[model samples]
Target: MRSDPALIGPLLERIAAWRAGHAGLFVLGVCGAQGSGKSTLVATLAERLTQAGVAVAALSLDDLYRTHAERQALAREVHPLLATRGVPGTHDVALGLATIAALERGEAAALPRFDKAADDRVPRGEWPHAPANAQVLLLEGWCLGAKPQDTAALAAPVNDLEAREDPDGVWRVHVNAALEADYQRLFARLDRLLLLAAPGWDVVAGWREQQEAELRQIGGARVMNPAGVARFIQHYERLTRHILSEMPTRADLTVRLGPNREVLELMPGA
Candidate 1:
């Protein structure tokens, strides 16, 4: 919904170039901090591509959230932090890989939709018809390609959210560990990577607050308050911080969003 063509134009240009050059299943990892407009960019690209007759399917990692009851059970047994979803472990990566693999093979696939209000995924049995001509798959999320920091540094104190539940940092530790081994396997599948370079936690906190406030006005009780937002940010702190630091070195291109959460710059990776 950004009015400025400065942001949209360059992104679309790159996407168009990539599509023109590659005929295989293209996976673009759209990564950013919470409320940093990653999904907005993804949707815009999908719309543009669809209009150009480049069949596109959009997939979000959020759709992979476990049922509420399942998360509660995980919190009690596996780790209370598991209830704090949005870190790397909250997703069914295997399912994601399978979904992508199927798309690569030109097959129609049914995908589950996650209900944020219910805090669980609904088995709506809805299937997205991947037309025989569909080409690009837009896979996006907070930790689409997140890797964790070093363990020795992991001993540092985390925010209250991490303390209240995952004091041991088990979720991130486990997630990063898995990512170190297999995430590259997945990343290699991407024809290109598009990163939404977000500001630090302080800036992310502001955007999250604004999002919650608007959500509150619109949906009444559905929106998470400032405290709830803080808790959610804590769950993503390590990875978010990681993205801010590591993405410049890892991504093919980067778009820095300003404190106002607007696209500040779109530039090549460092």
Candidate 2:
């Protein structure tokens, strides 16, 4: 909760280390479970780097969500299981790849924005020329580099949720099937992947509940609630745990966070 810039010294050091070595499209991924403070860290890092005279571009993978209408339509026809997101297949991976590639190539484009409470995207304008050779691009998301778990690996309860949305639809199976390829495409562009580590899915449940409460106060009753929060957590359970395990073996850096989402320690990836 402390806003002291001094607390983030080590993370800044790690990023600076990366910048000292290369100049090619530096993709910095801020990975965490839902509400684990990944977005806050990305925003802070981007601001600090920009203040330091480093060109920075901040993007969220959440914004890559399929529009509400599109998701609703998919939920009704092809698979209602497709309605809730957080899984890899629910996103526009190819579009994400294209946008990052374009940005790296110095092309101008508008960034996408999504409202979690509304579960929809709002239109926006093009991000200007990336301050010339932008030194950093911060990508924050729940499962930025998460690999899909096999349908068999999912808990028995998740199978029920998947079935509820799309009876006779093999949504989970199809979703896991695409994991390897999408992450491959996403990781290929990464200069470094930084994970904001949580103790367990409990971190997700707790922070998500807090977020919903705050939203109710700010955005009113239309915002998410305990039931909706639980439903949203259901979408990520399988891969969420998998990523928590996988990132320690895969990421370049991991910042362990407490229940309050405060940085507890620095965990270097194997």
Candidate 3:
């Protein structure tokens, strides 16, 4: 997706203005569905902010995913579906909280990186270090600022994956509870939040398919194919729909996008 200067320039101005007024570390949350171009937008925003002489650092919730072995143990203990990442319960949120606290304190912080191809976190030695005094922190992820669904809402399965694998509701309940607790605490640290609103959930699969195609072109390993992409996104269907429905009014800013991933509008939250 191409970054439109018409859109990004104004947004950056707003962010810069907000940063100027904020005292300490200004943490911004960029929330979006899978393949909604959040990572690209955050990277571009960071580059622009840096060029404008703002000390900035960016992190992804993807990077805080639980180690493969940890997830394996969770799967063995909770449910087999816990083995796959993406849900709230699958993240090492304590580590995420610690990292954020460190950044806010202006301490040199080692940022974690997850290797999706290896389905594991990169070794600590390889983790990147953030500058001690990053003035702005951008945390981007699919589930950032997502709220827990009420237990009644979780009664019905959203898709085949849940209907079949989570028939007993054990896994979904576990995920929702995590969102209510640790995830809420983690998100409470954001000074401002933005939602990259997708036109609809129906377009997510197609966009993700495009991403997988690009991954394949780069010889990326462990990339999902078309069918795999379909099933994999099922893991996120419930919360993706939740954020699409709920986050517009909840985020500090919302960037509405069309299926082509082009920016259509920028809106301030309630």
Best by lDDT: 3
- True-vs-predicted CA distance for residue 77, candidate 3, Å: 0.6
User: For residues 225-252, what per-residue lDDT tens digits would candidate 1 score against the true structure?
Assistant: 7888777767777777778888777787
Give me the displacement of residue 36 in model 3, in angstroms. Answer: 0.8
Q: In model 2, what lDDT does residue 130 have?
A: 47
- TM for candidate 1 is 0.91
Best by TM-score: 3
State the lDDT of candidate 2 residue by residue for 116-226, as single tens digits: 667777655533344555567888888887766665564344444554763544666666766777766886688788887888887787877888899888877567778
TM-score of every candidate: 0.91, 0.88, 0.97
| Ranking of models by TM-score | 3, 1, 2
Specify the poorest-scoring 10-residue window by lDDT in model 2. Answer: 124-133
For residues 195-243, write the lDDT of model 3, one tens digit per residue: 9999988998788889899998998888888889989989989999989
Candidate 1: list runs displaced more than 4 Å: 1-3, 181-184
Taken over the whole model, the C-alpha lDDT of each candidate is 0.74, 0.74, 0.91
